[model samples]
Target chain A: MKPTFRASMAWLHTWSGLVIGWLLLAITLAGTLSVFRPEISSWMRPELHGRLTDADTATQAAIGWLTAHAAHAPAWYLEAPSPRTPFTYAVWEDGTSYAQHALDPKTGAPDVLRDTLGGEFFFRFHFELQLPYPWGRLIAAVAALALVLILLTGIVAHKRIFLDFFTFRPGKGQRSWLDAHNLLGVVALPFHLMIAFTGAITLANMIMPWGLTTLYKQDFSALTHDFSPATIEREASGKPGSLTAFGPLLADVRHHFAPNGLARITVTNPSDSNAVITFNAIPSVSGVGVENHTLSYDGITGKLLAEHRETRPVMGFYRFLYGLHVAYFAPYVTRWLYFLSGLSLAALICTGLQLWTSKRCHRQQGLGFKLVERLNIGMMMGTPTAFAGYFIANRVLPPFLANRAQMEVRAVFCIWAAILLFAMVRRPNAAWRETLAISSLTCLIISLIGGIPHSPIEWAVSLVSLGIAVLMRYAMRYTPYRKKQS
Target chain B: MLLPLSFIGLLAVCLLAAATPRQASELFTPPLPHKQQILIRAFGFLLLAASFFVGSLSHNAGRLLIAHIGLLGLYAAIISLGCTLCLHNKKRRDPAKRRNNHT
Candidate 1:
């Protein structure tokens, strides 16, 4: 590319990266943490650790609980305990919405664990940006699209990327920042591309609803049917028939689907004679763990009704993308890699933002320059502090408080807001130092108070906090964001 | 164990590739010879490619391979950042000490 063309591309890359870098950091960090959703859930509910049982046993327990409580309900849902997540949950229709509870595997009683969103909050925020439905997702999709453009522009802009790959100049202010940005962007080029594209693909339907209409010939019901699990329906015979012991039926299904296990069970008209139960098989960890591959049976007679396994040619591709987005199929080792990649994303953005700020440090003292710097400090440092705060709130919050689960979520956002407000008032460099220090202290407190070295994850998180503190200290010592008057 | 082994091996390969020097210099550090750098990088790439094939035979199949590929890149970036940061801190202080002696 010509120098002029490359410089234009550079302008695009820099501007694009800076415009919404804060939001991207938040989204990416939340996303990366969500990879360990089940593990976090396990940590949050300490009571569920190591108490998981076989799918058949948990299914039976869930069935027994639902039978007693919601016999008259139209439908019942059971999530059998899996190897990954250790809770069996049952849900029944309550008025218009659903009432749900996680059941202890051993006794099948309602789980005494404190109510929390656990890993799911991060998952939702990844695409939703924590805003109400549609708008948050729409903005996320737009951001994903912009990220793809920025990546392309960045590649076009960096003419000597090969040389830059081999270079890292430490103490040279702007040069160091540029080299760091190029290094991070180039190293994870493939991951950055794949994550951006697959992320956009995830909201394919919402992005272009007309495309689904075209595929399904405007039959929304048909589209839903094609995507939904297989089911069998039976009319009520006006005779009440008790639910058969779910354990044997579940065992038989497990044996039939051995190696691949059960994920969910849905019982329709549980007290009626014509009741039907559907068993959905769980895909392997490295496979797309969607609620497909269903085996239906008569609730009254325990007779096998029908079965449908996922076998479509297109499904493999869809599952691949789904699996990539969810990281559902990864082993723990690979999962940590995803988490590290996420932290790198945060680092990448941090370096880019710092580079932008450093470039102007010697010349400009505009409101815009200060505004962007404040945002970077607010989000990059503030978000981590908020995450640590979330864990601490989970630990300290009383279980009996009204809507305590909501309160825990509120604590996370409240801290996030508080940090941003604090960032606005303080000097940007000091804000970076202070917020990172706070994050480090918060993480240390959580680790020690929760009994550090007790669990590998807890220890790992604590170390990350300490690492951030040390990193920020080095950053403060070497960079352009010193307290000199402009 | 196979997955982690392959993962660590891949990261080691990335670090080895990144160790090749960037600029030509006389004093402290010199770029590795071209022949050795190319040979080492080729070997690293081959091993990284081999992991996918071996992973399919392992229980997890192809899923672990793709994740490892992304992770290897991340590890490379972190290592690069760490090396540069260490240099920045050391060089920054060393120059200050030398200048102080002269002054």
Candidate 2:
């Protein structure tokens, strides 16, 4: 119990990281997968499983569809398809309830994706921990900040972190674990630093809102209105106005973008005479920076009225950081890099948890140690298997059932709960082997289950699952259960 | 195409790092003099990093910087695993030689 700096930091790193490490694993895995949110959404909806469409035409088609079907909505947001995303994604409010669906650009028909959340579940889960709104975001902020603290303390505690970055001595139990932990932690140091900071800063608005709160008297609406792009504003005319052709408007906006073109087109009060069409531009390049430019047009006349440009550097900085976190700028190859780094993060967290017992206490029957071991197996193995169950549920669930999406979400938790119970009751070693084997099987067979389309996305995902299976299989050999038998 | 090329360059760089006297000695390879090894390693790293810009600026540059760094880290991990496997194989076949070399 010496009160030395490194010792204090070591103690701090262990406890803080342990308590929040589960949360970190959950978020990191989901956040990594969230890199391909659009692709995942596309894959989940088999109805839209076809060749890609032209962006301009897709925008027009989406507009046409929304004009007819989404007229009841106060406004409609339509994102034109891209290389990675297959369709025109649309979102709008339906009498206080919100609705979002992906539409085929050619047909303007929404695909039959079971009301499942798909990748959005992961994306939202990343920042909000899937909790309700502000509270989820608050918890995410605390978790991210804790990660930042653990990383900083870890850097301080390890003297040879940089020198040992290349060292890895396997087959030496505790030594191997330490080396693996240090190597992964140090090699991905910059990434861990940037991701943790950016994640927290992205929620800085929620965590530290005093500045904005003071300026706008807690009216976030007013604060956003000032910086927001100008849009056409009008009271309801009570008379309906037919929308003009969206093709020319989309073409007009194409000139503004290089390589890539219009991203989203929104229609406000589509049925009213004062209806307006807002064309939002996306960056052509596959990297990060805010490209949320807005060009508002009179819906009836199809004439451009207002243009909103980026003028604030503060907002630009935040968007850059946000873009880094979400990785919307990454192409497919780069996306894999993000996913791999994210897995490294999860590995680091997992190793840290293992070291808590492996390096410290013995294999005692103490309740705390047993509980931690059970929780570790339950989370590390159970979470991924739960996702496998989710994907399977998305395929098997009756598409027409009411609250189908809710059922899909429930499937994840149900599978997770069942596995947790199993992990608690069974020996930890046996639990690990059984859960991983089930995960491997689920991932190995999802696409083979008839009706699910086998796209390149599915293939990429399958390769990852295969990698997980191999790792888990190798891990099964390391369990002390077999060692005891021998 | 660019991704694979980058990966190859990275693998070659890792192999070169393992070829260096300090690293080679640890991996059961003959230890050469340290002369110019540092320079060679730096040059190798530079060549690998330069590959990022060779094909398309948009492919690996700009917003993809984090992804670029992540890939490098992953390559490092793979290299570490490879080195560990090499050491393990050497130890299994001739434990006396490994002990003598270390001593």
Candidate 3:
């Protein structure tokens, strides 16, 4: 077979990656952090620092917290804490609304929790970019497809793939960068491919639920009933009843399901004749957000009523995929491995772009190179600048401000956009150095501010940032370029 | 034969690496043609060292340490070999260039 198709693919890969390298970098980095998000969030909140609670205590607290928070609600949802976390979060639907709150780790009492808007915001942005409903997801999905093509072409373009596997010569400017890119890309091929494909699949229902939509056309009720369970009608009962004895139902759930990493519990149609307490098992796999079972309990008598367990072959397959992708239930070794590899993938994308632009320094000091330079400016430094801004907003913004979380994101984008504009006007070499220094300094200062009430860890991180800034300044000043010999 | 295949391939990559003079034409410009051997070896070493920390944390220190260190050493050796090839190739190519241009 003529390698022309491969050559075209190579071209496609190069251009495709160059086109969306920044976006992919952001996604990969954020996704890597997302694996340890809960842990990071816990550390950020100094209030939750020393207190460690058992599962039973946390669970009880969750139950009480949900009941109090959603007293007048028709249904309640409790997200139980795992071994890693000390507190459980509870949410419930009231009249045309849903409210959520954290439960105390020690007593299962309703506790005001430290805001984790930063962690959650970053996590969501990784996947959805926090754009309007489906738009962010759609853009991300397209980027992921582009990424797959890039990887395939990249592999093919490097004819001596295995030969170049261990090649890395320092002081050889662009050559070293290429080696880094190839090494990372090849070594973590499985991870890179899986992350992109699975990330796309995460939004599959939104993108191509055509089969589900078509097969279950307009018979939405019947369709849901076919796979899941038919919703039984429940009439409200005026008599007040004690929800004290939910223990037996909980026991029943554990016994039947083998304690399936249950994250949340929901009691629907409360105060009704057919009040059903559905204990949803935490999602294990690709359905990271979706739960597996719906174990119903007679809300009044506390008796196990019905169960809709998704243990079938088809459901199991999805669960496995989701489980693998999330890496939550996986052993610690696997999760950390995934995190390191994901970081490498992010580094690969950035190094690849840097290598591309650096190689063409003299060839095209023209419009095209200028455009790439601006993009590199925006991508390479803009992201970290935006991230620093996000941290800044978290510390400076008034807690009572309306939609403060969203504002943090806006701050990030605003800073990122500003840097991109600066890159357009500034010289490429100057821009690279200035932006890195600025980003590092910004991160350092913002982290200091955020760390004031927190701990030394944030300050330590700031020192590292400042150190990076200084190092970048040195490199930018010292690194020399050879004049072209035509 | 395998060693020679590996050696030749590594040398080709190293020559390709050595050719990136920062002023090279875009058409023949090496992709990500920056420091080829040293950086790869450094990163490979760091990754292996990092795995040691991770392995120790997870109590899989013995097995993982051996595996990671072995892999790191192998890559480091290859990178060292690549460096030698790069130097040798540069010597050969530079002399040929001087002769052709009569410089």
Candidate 4:
């Protein structure tokens, strides 16, 4: 007999989710961590802590350093220090390659700190999967699409979604797992849908480039110019020229925008007579949009050249989708909500994976079933343990060690692999408990020796790590291994 | 202001949960009457709308809307867990009451 509509949906939901569930969890968890990327980066670079400088001073100092070190570069990019991040980040092309430095806000010198990717690693890994360009993003985009499909199918299959909104019965094994899964999925349904859909939209250009190919015809520069018409492109005149003082120009821009609205500054042909400086505004918080308002000035004369604001509806909508995905404009309360909702989505996926295994636990299991069972335990607990290992490695490794950043990332994968192998060798119940204990212990160790937090963001991160350790400890004790063993 | 708005959202979600017949039975000794349940559900929805209206008065209505939805979900989860614990406790006590009567 053919399956009913709901049954077919249930089948699709189960298979689609199971196929990419582990990858999706990793992506979601990393994305959640990325929500606090700036904070994490600041915490990792202890040398930059407690030293605050105004944006104007930092920008000038960074420019001075770049002028001395990279004068031959055609252009330079500068990110002013903000409350969240205390370092002035500068990037410039040096001959054939790009060089980046985190400058001390007070002195404009390259920060004397351990080299590490810090939170940027998680941000990149969330969408890029630590793979080379295009492939990781493509894979993540496909996984996001699959997640949307799974969510829709799960909604269709669960007929009592609304009726059982407030229902949960724990300690009943499989039934309990199903209830928890449904509860997590249904409670944050809108957020899950919004995040998945916006995530795909953010990478839509790469995922669906047929339109670009047909319209732009391989001229990427034309596409960029069309997308951002405010961008000024002028070749260097070759005649040596000096830049005008940045103080007056910055003050002028601040008068037009908010005091902190100027987020990035781009200097093109900084040593040429045709030099131009552009200031990009912060993402808009007043509405559901990203207004890429820009002001351009003649670098030599410091005279305003052009001012542009995003007004086209289609482009505005696109920017809004991108803005929503990144949440660049979120305030403190909203940011916390985004973080919690993200974790709830991860929890939803984890519970769904557990439900899949629990439903089949009593059956005559095949190799596939056994493999999935072990994998479910390994990936769910092992991934977080690996993340904690990354933090631990950051503190334990020698400060000036060569390839220190790579070593920290390697520690994550090494720990994850070890946990996966250990899970494969142990009983499922024991594997779960041992992995939880290890994860908890790693977090506890971080809290003990991660150094006293020098700022509010660092303090929050430290406290959160301690909180996770406590929760993991509770989970380790609460796991029903003892009853099953008896 | 956001704190009070979130509290209102939490109260609204609790009312809506209590209006559900199954949850009402678990939460109350005798389930609320059908007419009262309807009133409570309507009031719950009205409160949600009122909270949204008040929250949108801020300069950034979009941000408030997103945060409001997230907070509502959190409140619902908390209420669901609380109800589950309450029901478990009641179930545990009912058997003791029956045993005492038999004795």
DockQ per candidate: 0.44, 0.45, 0.06, 0.76
Q: Candidate 2 — which pairs collide? A: none
Residue A106's C-alpha lDDT in candidate 2?
A: 82
lDDT of 3 by residue, A1-486 (tens): 346877776677777888889889888777876776665555444456556577666676666655555556777767667765557766666577655555567656543444445365667888788788789988888887778778878877877765564455566667777777777776667677777776766666766778887887777767766666723335557665547465566666667666466666766656555566666676543233246677767777877677786767876666556655666654455556666677678778988887777778857478887798779777778876777677667667764466554576788889988998998888766677788778767756754664453444455446545665565566565334332323
Question: In model 3, which runs have C-alpha deviations exceeding 4 angstroms?
Answer: A1-3, A50-52, A93-100, A106-111, A219-244, A255-260, A271-273, A282-294, A395-403, A442-486, B1-103
lDDT of 1: 0.74
Candidate 2 docking category? acceptable
Our model 1 lands, by Cα RMSD against the true structure, at 4.0
TM-score of each: 0.86, 0.89, 0.73, 0.95
| Model 3 local distance difference test score | 0.64
Model 1, docking class: acceptable
Query: Which candidate gets the maximum TM-score versus the true structure?
Result: 4
**Pick by lDDT: 2 or 3, better one:** 2
- The chain B TM-scores of all candidates, as shown, are 0.60, 0.63, 0.46, 0.90
For lDDT, the strongest prediction is 4
Q: iRMS values in order, in angstroms? A: 2.7, 2.6, 10.1, 1.2
Q: Which model is ahead, 2 or 4, in terms of lDDT?
A: 4
Give the Å shift of residue A183 in candidate 1.
2.0
Model 2 ranges off by over 4 Å: A50-53, A111-113, A232-237, A284-287, A361-365, A450-454, A481-486, B1-25, B29-67, B96-103
List, residue by residue over A61-153, the lDDT tens digit for candidate 2.
777777777786778887777766757778899887888777766867665444667788888888887678899999999888999999999
**lDDT, residue A234, candidate 3:** 52
